[model samples]
Target: MGTPHSRRGNTRQRIQDVALGLFSERGYEKTSLREIAEKLEVTKAALYYHFKTKEDIVISLSQDLCGPIDELIAWAGTQPRTLATKQEVIRRYSESLRASEPFFRFMQENQAAVRDLAIGDSFKERMHALFGLLREPEAELTDQVRCITALFSMHAGMFALQDVEGDPEEKRKAILEVATELVTAANPPNRRPVRPDSAQTASP
Candidate 1:
């Protein structure tokens, strides 16, 4: 047989996966950690190694959930602010948000719990940082608004997309495409102001 350690790792992951499903289905406040332990066929002590309280489970799930989005934001920070770079940012962000759909459902269902935990503030800051990267400080008000709308559209699109027909992946791609187009239009070369130094332009 394979190593007991490997088997134990699998069981722990399975427990977490099952717990999140139950939490989402029944609502986090209504779902008990003991019930999760029972459903996973593991003793409570075994589950405790991975999660102490039900809140701990939700916290852990949220962390595992945001890891990819954090990584994408980090990656985007290192790229140039050209159209291609912006497009990739939108694509990766859409994919990450798509991956986070379950956590979104959890947040919607457990709004009170999430608010009590104050998890929303940090998430909003992360979003502002990402959108800040997408916008030019010198951009016109309309352009800045376009940037804001484009960024939020990617986030809100995932939730709005649930009822749309066809493949979920295709819908996500379309959302990214729309966001990328908005960013591209807002950053057009002509609208971008040239510095007074006349470095890239003929002398007046």
Candidate 2:
């Protein structure tokens, strides 16, 4: 049997999962806390014990999505500016969003509700921070586009690849591959010219 604390944790995650699905299906404004409780087969009192309101649920979910991104941003800030770091940032960002794909869909379908809530603004700020880390200050316009495109491609892939065939993980990898390629293209390695041989007299 699970401990009381584990049970409470499970209930909270279950609530979040159901609420996100309900929000995605019926739109955030149309979904109610009662409906969420009913869907979870839990009493309203039980639901209230975890989340007080619909807005709170959304905020919790958004925070879950942003937490890792915030960590990534902080880590990137301390790293030396290099191509490998940018690629790893892209890679980690992709991994972070894997579990939040449904949240992305919710945001897409409920743009007005998202705008009304703080989630949109907070998410945008994180995205901007990620973009800043992806591109250098003196990058050319085309390179800048590459960096932005890489991020958006991952965003787009969650929905865009829905109709495509193959495993979800495979599709995710494909998207990551493309995004990584874009990042690499945006930050190509510097090529050092080869120095002429100074002691080639014997060879000649």
Candidate 3:
């Protein structure tokens, strides 16, 4: 038999996966806990044991996504603020966002719900922290835009390119390439040049 810890984790992940599917098919507001439980073929009581409410479900999902970003921020904090560090930040961030395409779609469709839940505020704070790591305080406005745009390109690419009809991993690499170029170009020429093979080992 599996450990109790693994069993509990499986149940929570199942609930989250089912809830996200319902949220995407039906609007977030329209999807109910009873509906989620019914679809899972599990009892309402069982669902409640894991998630008390729909907001709780979203909070749990957001926390899972934010945890890595928070760790990335903490990791970046210890490293010197160089272009390589910034590139690693972009790489790790792209990796973090890869599995969150469904969540991104939910956020896009439920902007009002996202705002009401304060998910937007929490995500914005993390972006600000990342921006701090990507650019120096004294950087010019254009360079600042470059850094922000680079991050945004990676975030937007997953959603924007979903329908483009090609290999998903390749698309991610292409997007990462563009974002990396933006950051590299934003840096001074005196800085070391970015390696051409950086994208291959970017997430590795």
Candidate 4:
């Protein structure tokens, strides 16, 4: 038999998954705790044992998504700010977005709800922190724009390519490749590691 904690954890995950699906299918405002309980085939009391309200469930989902991002930011902070570091940040961020694609879809669809919620402000703050990590301190204006665009392109690509017929992972790789190129271009030549081939062709 599973431990009580493990069972509770499973129930909590089920509630969150079901609630997000309902929120996506119906609008966030239209979805309710009772309906979530109904979808999960659980009683109101059982659902309430994990989440008290729709807002709580949304907040929990946001926190779950934010956790990986927060860790990524912290990890980047410790690394030397180089082209490799920025590219890795982009790569890890893409993976994180993929993992939380459902929550992102919810946020994109429910703009008003996201704006009214605490998660909105929190997400904005995290994005600012990530932007700080991606751009160089004394970069030219164009490079700065490249860094910002690189960050948002991942978000845009997620929805923009939905109608296109292709493997999802390939689309993700295409987005990541573009993002990586942007960051690489944003970095000053001095900041980029010299390739052996480029080294051979040096003017010096």
lDDT winner: 4
**Residue 107 lDDT (model 2):** 92
Per-candidate count of clashing residue pairs (backbone under 3 Å):
0, 0, 0, 0
lDDT of 3 by residue, 1-204 (tens): 222344355888778778987898898999999999999899999999999999999988888756878999989887766788888998888887775666777887788888888678998899899888787667789999999999889888878998999999999999999999988877774665444355566885
lDDT of each: 0.74, 0.85, 0.82, 0.86
Clashing pairs in model 1, backbone N/Cα/C closer than 3 A = none
lDDT of 2: 0.85
Better of 3 and 4 by TM-score: 4
- Listed in order, each prediction's TM-score against the native is 0.79, 0.85, 0.85, 0.87
Cα lDDT for residue 7, candidate 4: 38
Worst 10 residues of 2 by lDDT: 191-200
What TM-score does candidate 4 get on C-alpha atoms?
0.87
Report the lDDT tens digits of candidate 2 across residue range 65-182.
6678899899987775678788899989988888567788999889999999988899889889999988876789999999999999999888898999899999999999999999
Error of 1 at 17 (Å): 1.5
Give the RMSD in angstroms, all C-alphas superposed, for model 2: 9.0
lDDT string for model 4 (1-204, tens) is 222344356777778788888998898999888899888889999988888888899998888766899999989887777788888999999999898898888888888988998889998999999999899768899999999999999999999999999999999999999999999899965875434255357899
Where does model 1 exceed 4 Å of error?
A: 1-9, 190-204
**Candidate 3 lDDT score relative to the true structure:** 0.82
